[model samples]
Target: MEMLTLECPYCGVQADETELHAGGEAHLTRFGPGSSDADFEAYLFMRENPKGVHFERWRHVNGCGKWFHAARCTMTLEVFGTYPAQTAEPPKKIRDAITAKRPGWTWRELS
Candidate 1:
């Protein structure tokens, strides 16, 4: 397995994989109480495991102890950028970086 060195979007510190924790996929809708069983199941288990570009949640445990989203390539382990966790979508800069590297990539209808 390869290691990833990502920059903490909050603290601006570059940390290796050992200093951070992987929090699975980012930008997922949460299903709380009163939601259907299927919706809750999907929320708990369903996730995108693509072979190429991917976005994921990462916590800067050793640095600022804050969570952020990272855009990277699953196949090549190339990190495009990292952004604040609170962002609703990937920022324009990150998207542009992915575009420059990927050419024709799209995630959940955002191209």
Candidate 2:
């Protein structure tokens, strides 16, 4: 799939489609022992296909080579913001933007 121009948050480089690689969903915690099959399936395959706020991972393959998280709207394909992949959750600004755009929407705290 063709990717759009992505700006690297770490190095401040605007990477073209060819310079970046799309990673799958971010912030996934691996299921361990004592977990049921359904739970494992949810972690490995079942993903959120929401029409509103979504978060994804991107790698600046040909530029900074750092992984970052991008928050975007699935319906509009509008990018809200991006940040380092090491973060545990979406930044406050991104959350605020999404909340403003999608009134009454609240982010669920992942267990």
lDDT string, candidate 1, 1-111, tens digits = 788899998988989999999999888989989999999999999888889889999999888899999999998999999999988789999999999999999776667
Candidates' C-alpha lDDT:
0.91, 0.77
lDDT of 1: 0.91
Please give each candidate's TM-score.
0.91, 0.80
Which predicted model would earn the best TM-score? 1
Candidate 1: give its CA RMSD in angstroms.
1.5
The runs of at least 3 residues in candidate 2 whose Cα sits more than 4 Å from the true structure, single-residue gaps closed, are 1-3, 106-111
Task: Give one digit per residue, the lDDT tens place, for model 2 in 1-111.
Answer: 544566689998877768888887777777878899988988889777677777889999887789998877767667777889888788788788777777676444531
Instruction: Judge candidate 2 at residue 9 and give its lDDT.
Output: 90
Clashes of each: 0, 0
